[model samples]
Target: MANFFTTALFPVMNQYFGMPVTFLIHGVICLVYFFFVKTSVPETKGKSLEEIEKLLQKG
Candidate 1:
């Protein structure tokens, strides 16, 4: 599913924005995703199912 969008959008973005700009855009997107996961997702390492569920339910 992700590949489908990447294949479709990459060429158009590259054509209009050029390679460097396209990569910078992707970099910004990755930074946004990093922050979102860092803040919004819970850490589940060594945690039990019940604990994880409680964290999600609290949200």
Candidate 2:
């Protein structure tokens, strides 16, 4: 998925913004994505599968 976006957008981004700006934009995008997932996803690191299933089922 990341590869797909990189391949599809790299040319357009590079053409418009050049390599440095393109990389900065990608970094910012990744940071935003990281925070979005961090906040919205539940942590199940120590939980059993059954407990995880119940958590999701509650939602």
TM-score of 1: 0.86
How well does each candidate superpose onto the true structure, as a TM-score?
Answer: 0.86, 0.84
The TM-score between candidate 2 and the true structure equals 0.84
Candidate lDDT scores, in order, read 0.88, 0.93
Please write out the lDDT profile of model 2 over residues 1-59, one tens digit for every residue: 98799889999999999999999999998998899989988899999999999998987
- lDDT tens digits by residue: candidate 1, 1-59: 64587678889999999999998987887788899999988899999999999988998
RMSD of each: 1.5, 1.3
